[model samples]
Target: MMGGSAYENVGKKWDLGVEEQEWFHGLLPRVEAERLLIEDGDFLIDDDNSILEMVNQYCLSGRPWLDNSDIVLKNPIFREKWLLQNDDIILDRKLGKGYFGDVNKGIYKPMGNAVAVKTCKETFTQEQTKTLLTEGRILKQYAHPNIVRLIGIAAQRQPVLIVMEFVEGGDLLNHLKKQQKPFTSQQLIKMCDDIASGMAYLESKNCVHKELAARNCLVGNGLVVKVSDFGLSRDKVVHTMSDKNKPIPWKWSAPEVLLNGK
Candidate 1:
């Protein structure tokens, strides 16, 4: 509620810009705001108008929000439980090759759980590594039965790895292509239902999957389908496309995305 000429003068005295003064709670001191942001996701606008996410201790601006709490409330942020120790993971065999590097089947020793490990190749471009990390961050905040879960990420050393829940059936595209017999109507309906459920969950959290296709969905035991790849996902409901040159899956994309590039 800090606005108007009087507060603007105070903001100037504090060396805060005009934009900062718009949302700046000038009357609230840092100590009091810190005291208020005690719970997880608890935040306050500082005198600088930057959002102080106390639990994560990050100053964010422009469309920043707390993680999806509807799925799992008060859980540890990305750097906490989501950062895995490299020694705890033991890679078994190569599952497939991915965009940045190889995907391997592995065991997470701590929980004795089978996991899918995605590594960043040494020769990867900066954009590739960033996409991998970005996917990890997006996946870490979600929890749904029809969405693949992110176990954690091992990024302390080279060949950064993304560990995820392992699904035995693999990608839906290959499964569909390999099917010897056509699926029954009920089975096809179930698969579509599962995909819808996962996408619904993401929508509830205000996330948009920029690229969703059969190749990005995984089939689990009992023919359960789960939404997987999130390299192009965005947390915002509306995404602004800055690069029209970036390639998109023309065949799989919606007409609006193909026409508007967003």
Candidate 2:
């Protein structure tokens, strides 16, 4: 690992040969450097300013480094802080089920609080595991009232678990369906406004909620709505869905997204 002493010489311009530049690039955090290389083949190690510019552009673009196998292998600092022991969580009952796995109501021992634990399926592959970790990282960065908060992740367990704040009222769609009376216009407007505000925050962060609907939103106390289900979400200034084989939510998708495949 590159030490603090190495970074101290960052401003100094040295005559770096092709071999030396390649070696220096290899010393960087694999995921970050590799992602930038994927976007632009040039490493831009000619000068400190060029390297800074490349990183700045990457951050401005808001493209998430979701597939960082090396980072995963290294067990990054964030992972160490967020990873929970298997014994720390006690599952209570099933809350809901999805394509990837089931979510359950649980109690986190460390905090002595109720939490919603979403676990991966037993038959998950390496890609699925990486995606789960990516979601955890995304949630960790976002701190808004209208967005569901992620407590931590149980990475060492058999079925990797995602611990999130337990929204007592449950999903907005189910809450609406179960209600005997329809919501008043004012109440309906408030809910819509809440969702819009959440999306606005996400947009500001250069993130896109590809799947935004009542079903994916959660209702908290006082009927406050918070957006959830980020499995299909992307943190990019301009995201194009290249996987044509995957099914799209046609009803919720825009015309451009459907036609242009974005």
Candidate 3:
């Protein structure tokens, strides 16, 4: 898509901030961590910037992550469980996520049961806000079991709140791991079936998840899987980029979207 490119791993060597270091290690392999070789503290985000610009154009987007792939995970966005009152049970408080509140898995107190919470952290941007609102409204319109459900939105202060059905089983990536407990080839095929079914539903509704990837597909307690992470998705027209376009998680993107260095 226009304004987006495969991300570069310019400064993957820097230490993740004290706040973000833990989660950073959990998601990455040590070999992947060691390959990082850039220093990105000098990058910045400017207005009129595209998603790729917000990330790749500046070091913040690429910092601490090595050997850039299309899956651009930077800027831990979720910091704590303060979004809820004392009764909340946070399943996960993600960190260093970009442009949106650090996403989390937990239960809203007043509203019982497991649900996903996307807090609108400082990273929340106009572009991301647009994506969040659009995705939420779209998700609400459908009642499909294949897609994650949006029960309600907290939409309070800064980190806007989005309440969704908490997917029990980990993402497809985790399920793919664990040699002693890995899914069988048949199970993998079934996962593909569930994902396809969800995508067909999304397509029928004219939704476009521009950043689709294995992780974006949410898997339930060993039973269901659905597409997620709405920020890179679109509900409107998308086009080409300028000649100097920067990239985002490159491995996740199509090659043409990347601009050759001018």
Residue 239, candidate 3: alpha-carbon lDDT: 23
Predicted structure with the largest lDDT when compared to the true one? 1
Count of backbone clashes, every candidate in sequence: 0, 0, 24
Better of 1 and 2 by lDDT: 1
Question: Candidate 3, residues 19-81: lDDT per residue as tens digits?
Answer: 222112122222323444233222222112224333433434443434654434333222122
* lDDT of candidate 2 over 1-262, digit per residue (tens): 3233222333422354322232132112245345544322233232223454334334334333256522211111112345566568999999989766999999999999999999889799867766676777677788899999888877553577889999999999899999999899999999999999998998788777777878999999888999998887765654457689999997876455667676
lDDT of 1 by residue, 15-77 (tens): 433222233333233443565545644333433334323312222221234464322122111
Model 1 residue-pair collision total: 0
Ranking by lDDT: 1, 2, 3
Report the Cα lDDT for residue 25, model 1: 31
lDDT of every model, 2 decimals: 0.69, 0.68, 0.52
Error of 1 at 192 (Å): 0.5
Task: Give the runs in model 2 whose Cα sits over 4 Å from its true position.
Answer: 1-80, 237-242, 254-256, 259-262
Off by over 4 Å in 3: 1-98, 123-131, 237-262
Single out the weakest 10-residue window by summed lDDT for candidate 1: 70-79
